[model samples]
Target: MENPLTPDALLAGVRRTRLVAIVRGNDGPAAGRAALAAMEEGFQYVEIALTTPGALDAISEVRASAPVGCFVGAGTVLTKQDVDNVAAAGGQFIVTPSLAPSIEEAAGRGIPVLAGALTPSEAYEAMNRGAAAVKLFPASIGGPGYLKALRDPFPDIPFIAVGGVGLDEAAGYWGAGAIAVGLGGPLFGDAGSGGDLAPMRERARRFVALATQYDGRAAAESLR
Candidate 1:
C-alpha cells in the first residue's frame, strides 16, 4: 500500500509532533524493532540512518510494518545513489548530515529532504538548493540558544535539531524555534547492545509527553 502522507504533510506532521526518533540499530531487525517501539510510544516520525548495518533493508521493513500516519525516512544519506536507494526502499523522506547535491534528487522525487547546516549561509544555500528543511547538526555544541539565534534570520525555514539531543532537551529545542528534534541514543538507547527495551519505551514516552507539551505551548503562543 502507498504511504498516505505527502511531502508537505510529512513536514507538517514533524512540526506537529516536534519529535523524530532516529533509529540506528545494529542490524535490520533491530532497527525495525526499535522503530516500532518508538511508534508505540507515540512518535509519528522515524529516521533510519544509513550508517546502520543493512539500513536499506531496515527502512523497507519499518515502512512495510509501520502503522498509518507514521512517517519513515532515511537519514545520514550522502550520495545520489543513496537517495535513490532510499526511495526504492519506500522511505518517505530523506535527511543528510551535510549539504549535498543529492538533496535535489530527493526533492525531484517529491521526497522531503532535510539537509544539514550549522551556519546561516549554509542554511540559506540548502533552502535555495531545494531542501525542505535544514538540520542543525551537533546541535549540542551551541545548544538551544544557538538555534534560537539562527531562527532570528531564517524565520521561515524549518529547522530540525539533530545530534546529541537528549530527552530532557527536546522541549528546549522546540522552545528555541526548532520545528522538530531528532533523538537517537537518548531515546532508543543502545538497543543493539541486547539491553531491555522497556526502559527505552519509558524514555520514549517521556520524550513524547514533553514534546507534546511544548507543542501546545507554541500553539497557544501563536494564538496570543
Candidate 2:
C-alpha cells in the first residue's frame, strides 16, 4: 500500500472530489465490497462508518485494495479508541458524527478529520480544534438556506453538507456554497447489506456526472 497523504493533501483530494461516500452495513466483507465499488465509480473519498459490523477489518481490506487516489476512512467515529483502531487499521482519514474526542485524537496523530456539527457555535468550535473541514450534520432540517446562513459568519470555513442529502438536493447544497456534499443512504441503498451493486453503480454514475458537470474543478481529479 502507499503511504498516507498528509492532512493538507487529503483535504486537497476532498476539495477536488467534492463528494464523500459514507458506507454502512451489517457485515464486513459486504461493506468492503460496497466501498470498493464506490471507489471504482469515482467516489474517491469513501467512509465506512464504524457502526457497521467489523468496520475496522473492512477499512484494512479496502485500504490495501482501493483504486489509486481513493481514500478509505472510518466514519461515525465516537471515541478515542475508535480513532486508535482506525489508525491501526491503516485508515487514511477520520470522520465523526459530532464534535467527539476522536476528532482531537485523530488530529493529534496528524490524521485529517471532517468534524461534524450543526449549530454555528459547534461548527466554529470544531474548526478551532483543528478540523480540516466542518461536516454540517443533519443538514436537512434547515436545507440550503441554513448552510448559506452559516457561511455568512464563517466565510472561509469549508462546510460539507451531510445527513439526508440526496441527488435531488445536491445542487441546492452546492449552490448554497458547500465545499463538498456528504452522501450515504441515497447513494448506497442496500448495497452494503448484500444488495445488488448494479443499481448502486448507476446511482454513483449519476452523482459523478452531476458533480463533474456542476463543478469542472472537481472533475479534474475526481473523474480521472
Candidate 3:
C-alpha cells in the first residue's frame, strides 16, 4: 500500500482503512510531530492543513520523518499553485475544502485529490472533473441520513465524509457508504498545537478499532 500510485489503489486503501487524520495547527513543527504520532498508531494517510503556519514545511518535515509506507498530504489546497507547492514538498496527495481548480490540476500532475463538495451538483461535478473522491464537507448538516440519500444517486462516486466528524459519527458515515472519514480536531485534539500526544494516540487507537468493524462502502451498498 506504499505510495498508492493509482486512484483505484489509493481509494481502495481508504475504503478499507476507513479513516484519515487531518492535522491543523498554528505551528508547523508541532503539526509535523502530531502527524508522525498519528502514523505510529496505524494511520496510513495524514493530511496537514495549509491553513497552519508554515504548512508546507510541516508536510516536508513529516514526509521525511515518516516510515517508508506512510503517505503525507496537504489539505485546504485551493489552487494549482498550492498543488505544485505540495508536490514539491513531497506531499503525496491534495485535499481541497471545496470544488477548486486544484482538483484537475492535481489530476493532470498524476496526483490524487479528495475534492470537497457539499451539494449534489458539486458532488457530481467534482467526480467528473477528475477528483479521486468527493469530500462531504460539514456532513453534520444532514448527517448519515443525508449521505445515504446521496449514495442512492451517486453510488459510483467514492465519498469521504469530512468536517465535524468525530468518533461517534464515524460509524454512521461508514454505514451511509462513505469510503472514509476525514477527521480534524476530534482526532488531533490539541496535539497539533503541542498538546498531549498520549491522548491523541489513545483516540487514534479507539477510532481505528471502531473503523475496522464497519465494512465501508461495499457493505452499505449491499444492504441497500
lDDT of each: 0.82, 0.88, 0.87
Give candidate 2's TM-score: 0.94
| Per-residue lDDT value at 109 in model 1 | 72
**Best lDDT goes to which candidate?**
2
Clashing pairs in 1: none
Model 1 misplacement above 4 A: 1-3, 192-194, 215-224
Could you estimate the TM-score for every candidate?
0.91, 0.94, 0.93
Candidate 3 residue lDDT tens string, 19-84:
889999888889999999999998988999999998999999898889766789999999989987
Candidate order by TM-score, highest to lowest? 2, 3, 1
Write one digit per residue (lDDT tens) for candidate 2, span 1-224.
33476778877877777799999989888999999999999998999999999999999999999898888989998898998788889898889988899988888888889999999999999998889999999999999999999999999999999999888788788888898899899999998888999999988988888787885233322332
Per residue, candidate 1 scores C-alpha lDDT tens digits across 36-138 of 7888889988988888888888889888888777878888988889987988899988888888877888888778888998999999999888888889998
- Cα error, candidate 2, residue 209 (Å): 0.5
Candidate 3: which stretches are off by over 4 Å?
Answer: 1-4, 215-224
Q: lDDT score of model 3?
A: 0.87
